[model samples]
Target: MGDELRADQFRTEAASPRGFRQVYVREGVGGVPLLLVHGWPETKRIWWRNIAPLAAAGFEVIAPDLRGFGDSDVGPDGFHDVPSHARDLYALVRGHLGHERVVAVGGDLGGPVIQDLSLRFPGFVERMVLFNSPLPYDRERMAGLRTRPPREASDYFVPQGTDADALAAELATPEMRRRYIATFYTSRFWAHPGAFAPEEVDFMTEPFGDGAKLRASFGAYESTFSEAARSEPTAMACPNPTPTLVLFGPSDHVIYPDFDRMAAAVFPEHTGPFRLRDCGHFVQWEAAHALNSAVTAWCGDLLAGRRRQ
Candidate 1:
């Protein structure tokens, strides 16, 4: 399953007007455009296991490294918040690739990004598949969803949000940075235990060895505490109306336990908050076959509709 994506076959880059070049993997052709957005501490490589399977399942799988996370260039202006990430994607998929409609799939930080994309450009994102990602918290509708990530599970958030510069400085060397990022895949228990082998961990953390990219990857966390990097008031208040299919990986230790409930509350037109056992936060990597099956099955009618068009 890990051998699904070949760099030579799908790797490509698109220039963004936002003053940076974005690197991505473009697989399959002449099929429905399915955009795969990756999250923090990861790059487009996170979807390596899912891309080919999804493409073969009859969709064009487009996975890009969010700005500054991998081969993509960081924003010259230094903003890496969810809105900025969403805009970059819009320019790449809609403006550049000429896809006016697409199925957006994401988890982790990528989850909020796809959410923003759907809300900001509803017509463009025709449908969505969200898993193990954060969703808007509605106090009334989500009153029964009280589970939060355990304190030990989230101990890294504060320093990453408030002291990025200091933390970046502390992780001065490439080796140090990779070591730090490796924890998220291994000791951090973000994935189901034993999901990743040593070589797999190396492949996932390699991009973080670049100190600059590693620091820039912290932009999402920094945005949590920085007013300038936060999403706009209107964006935060609006509910996402895109037809969505939500999935949960119960073994995840880093994300909120009640992610399904929150996602159900936020997406007005939504499908299953289906839970996958033995999977964790990194669903694409840990549950590749299941993810592919769910996406292909859920979007069957939409895919058929596109074929008719």
Candidate 2:
């Protein structure tokens, strides 16, 4: 896999006003600077498949490994909450990119982070694109986790005996792993039977092999949401005028089935919604071509207008 494509890394120090440590990524080139933030249990590597294509289409892309995930230094107290995460994002963009205004593209946990980033740092963000994220939705109404109690892990792979161990174990097993993979590809992932090349599956599974790492990643998810919900409302009081686009699989099981409604309520004025037929939560991975095309076209329109202005 290392021979297939080379990934370059850039390191920079970004601190939230609270003195919390934050690290982010900067990659790709062209068009407006676009920051791509990955969700829980995933690293900046999640953007591997999309970066080159987007860069080729003339868009500068940056996919950052949020705090407590990947190689970034973990915060002492762990700034896993939403506002802190968003603030970390704000610092990263402001301190590293040096662009007063840019676009943010996020999915899953990155979705809400970007949403808060847009609201909190409105002037710095010119536009937003959210993929299969649960933003501005009632926590109690979330579809998949509605009945389940909030997970207690601080990161993606919690230890087996720990509260989040079961989830970690499930993701590690063959059958549950297949189902988890299906959550991304939906019916199509199974169409080819051998569709998930062993190498591809290995790449996905490699990160979670270590129980400690897995637990930390799982814990990040649990910690971020609870923090976000508590602080997001106060931070998101003002309506965001930045033009935003939302794309999702209507049949997604991870996000609420009624996500469209949530998207509407989140960005009342500047939101455009697109539903991918038969797609699931991992739209970017499962439907890369479609997702890339949609984003490229939308970004093209925005960039062209910026030039015209």
Candidate 3:
């Protein structure tokens, strides 16, 4: 954790025209901007390990806690679906931050948001670095790929999506909610075993201690089961034209086992689909050095531009 970006020092809040206040970490000064989006059971803290390294490699890193997660507000409308998240980011980057183009990087739920961002607002995302994220199902292209998540690993989905209200009610207390989210970080095998120490787990679960935010975070899952719960940018136009670099951490039991293959099929302009050993769902933390090296190498031209200056 040497030179890690401290959330307390850099976190800032920007009012989104779309109606929520976005809390994000904006680091680095004038290099090519890259947005590092986090997914379910995670906050911007997930990228803390990789942020300083990436900024050092010559890129401005913007990591935001999607609405309803971390310190960010859930907004009056209470929509946390992919499209809604994408729109919030669109407004944050293009509208508030004033960056016309960005290199989008995300995993888990962030995967869909970036995908939707690239599709819904073409030219906004110049490239993408995706890992441990969801890919749109295409029958023909993903013919041989294991596109569906393993059933044993997916027990949390139905409960979270369909019974969000009841589930939230059942969890009841902050400690109960944190315990539930803690499983994804531990026994759930969302990360490679032994990735998180006890203190690290405490840091990650601290934000979930808020009952309201935890409940709002379930909206994304709910959108999948009910159309009525969807936001405007609901469907992502696949075969996303944006050039992408796909990295997979195979140890993750929660997502599609053949994610690398499936991602390659869906993103025609994709590179690598590289698999990192001993890594799992949380690529940034599990394989920090590798993830940092990959991102810097993938965006060499951008880093070089800064060198040329």
Candidate 4:
């Protein structure tokens, strides 16, 4: 929506350990706490459309801007990665919510962070809902998936280069800005072109209008992905056979092709997979009602011991 349209009201809170800044939006007065994590180049505001509905249905919701995103303080290193993001989320849960266990719902980059969090702190994660993120990249599969060769480090950080100033200027133009967002969302909304309202595009692009800000943000993604690729996978076991739900948009250009195989490999014994038709990467935004309904119903079933096998 427009800059003035406050999708959800948020309160700033101090994160423990390092006293890092965090923005949290909470709704509903009872029921289990649910944390919503957004993905790359996005902020907690992305979950705006879903918060009220869930809250109205008697669920408590908490969404935060991951480090270096939105108003949250960039981490001590001014970079973002899966481990650090997972830790930040942990701090938010344990320190702020004072909860030993809670459910986590994540999309895109957030998906991997949630996976890592559940792995690192097995006792803390109660349930997990992962969308459009593959399991940890496996070496054998990486070779088969490599349709394109890796670029040099310099090329890889194009958003961090000095030319980023010029790139931002070009992206500022209405036409280019629309194209940029459409490149990611259009494929998901192919069957429903009107799915992503114009305001949504504005909401997604407004934060990146500043060249330096955009560069720093993208730089973090580039750096983080590099580190996650090398970091050893956490060996912790699944937390209490927690009920897990996996969702995928069949048309998602980045994830659909590999999700089934990855899920079969990583969470072989537990979990149910739901694939949305004619939708792409941004499943929540593109199909909020359908997504929320499915997730809420699944949570209800799990709580009542009626979850599908």
Candidate number achieving the greatest lDDT relative to the actual structure: 3
User: How many clashes in candidate 4?
Assistant: 1
Clashes found in each candidate (C-alpha, N, C closer than 3 A): 0, 14, 0, 1
Model 3 segments more than 4 A misplaced: 1-9, 307-309
> How does each model score on lDDT?
0.85, 0.60, 0.88, 0.63
True-vs-predicted CA distance for residue 231, candidate 3, Å: 1.8
Taking all chains together, each candidate's TM-score versus the true structure is 0.95, 0.72, 0.96, 0.76
Model 3: residue 79 alpha-carbon error in angstroms: 1.0
Of 1 and 4, which scores higher on lDDT?
Answer: 1
In the range 1-309, model 4's lDDT, one tens digit per residue, is 454346435544545454567666777645566788888657777787787787665567778877667666666655566777788888887776777777788887788788878878876877888777646555554455432312321242455333544666767755564466454444433224556666666666565444444544554345444553223444324232456777767565555465754554456444667777766667777778877887687678434442232
Best by TM-score: 3
Error of 4 at 154 (Å): 16
Q: Report how far residue 128 has shifted in candidate 4, in Å.
A: 0.7
Q: How close is candidate 3 to the true structure, as a TM-score?
A: 0.96
Instruction: State residue 99's C-alpha deviation in candidate 2, in Å.
Output: 1.4
Model 2: residue 18 alpha-carbon error in angstroms:
9.0
Candidate 4 is scored at a TM of 0.76
Better of 2 and 4 by TM-score: 4
Tell me the deviation in Å of residue 288 in model 4: 1.2
